[model samples]
Target: MADVRKHMIFHGRVQGVGFRYTAKYLARSMNLTGWVKNEYDGTVVMEVQGREAMIFELMKGLNRNQFIQIDWIDTEEKETETESSFEVKY
Candidate 1:
């Protein structure tokens, strides 16, 4: 399958709630490569690159978090990058 990249911006109570850490962990477990960072506008932005199924699974994993309330997600399909690992960007 051709790898895909998704650029997502998650809104709601995402920051200061371990969202980035959880995303990083889930991405590593699923062997997805990308980076996640907290936006200045109280949102979280992430770019996940992997198979379609794995990327969806990562989203599901993120939604399962109790403290992180994802009110909305703005997603865009982008050209894939040669990222080797997922990281929590500061």
Candidate 2:
């Protein structure tokens, strides 16, 4: 499938854990591009763009981490980006 972008808000136990790092790793390894950051509300926000399957795999990878307990994820599709890297934004 073609590339797609998703803006996501991950809730519950996202901060104080290695959520950002894990997301960056997973995204990059899968050749996905975008950024992840911690929000002031103790939630994690991310925008990732890549193949649909890879995006799904990225979600599965995040959920597999023992420390990152994602109570829920709010996701929305967006216009794709040109960047070719995944990052953990500060």
Candidate 3:
């Protein structure tokens, strides 16, 4: 399958839970490229790019994390990037 990219806003208890690191690990493990960051409004924002299935897997990994309590995710499709690494944005 072709690669896809998503811009996601994760809501509900996402801050201060090592969410960025967790996302970075998962994304890198899956060879997904993009970035994750904490929002001042208590939400986590991420842009992930990879195969559609891998993206789905990334979501699953995050949802399965014990410390992260995700109430909902707001997402949109985005144009993919050429970056080769996933990162935790400061």
Candidate 4:
């Protein structure tokens, strides 16, 4: 199956925290491919692409815990791509 990509923007106190690192770990463990970066406006933006079920699982897992303060999770479907593995943005 082709990889489905999603552009996600996480709002709230997401910066200066370990949200990015944790997200990277989660994505890696889930075997998803994408990049996660912190926005200047204290928002965390990410481009995640992977299997449908794994993607949904990762998103749900992210929403479950209270590690990061998630005010809102705005996501949009994007174009598909061939992703090798997940990673964290510098």
The most accurate candidate by lDDT is 1
In order of listing, the candidates' clash counts read: 0, 0, 0, 0
Count residue pairs with overlapping backbones in model 3.
0
Error of 4 at 37 (Å): 0.1
TM-score of each: 0.97, 0.97, 0.97, 0.86
lDDT of 2: 0.93
Per-residue lDDT for 25-66 in model 3, tens only? 999999999999988899999999999999999989988989
lDDT of 4 by residue, 1-90 (tens): 777899999998778778888778889998888999987788899999888898889877777667778888999999977778778787
Clashing pairs in 3: none
After superposition, candidate 4 runs with Cα above 4 Å error:
none
Q: Candidate 3: TM-score?
A: 0.97
**True-structure Cα RMSD, model 2:** 0.6
What's the lDDT for candidate 3? 0.93
Where does candidate 2 stray beyond 4 Å?
none
In angstroms, give how far residue 90 of model 3 lies from its true place.
Answer: 0.9
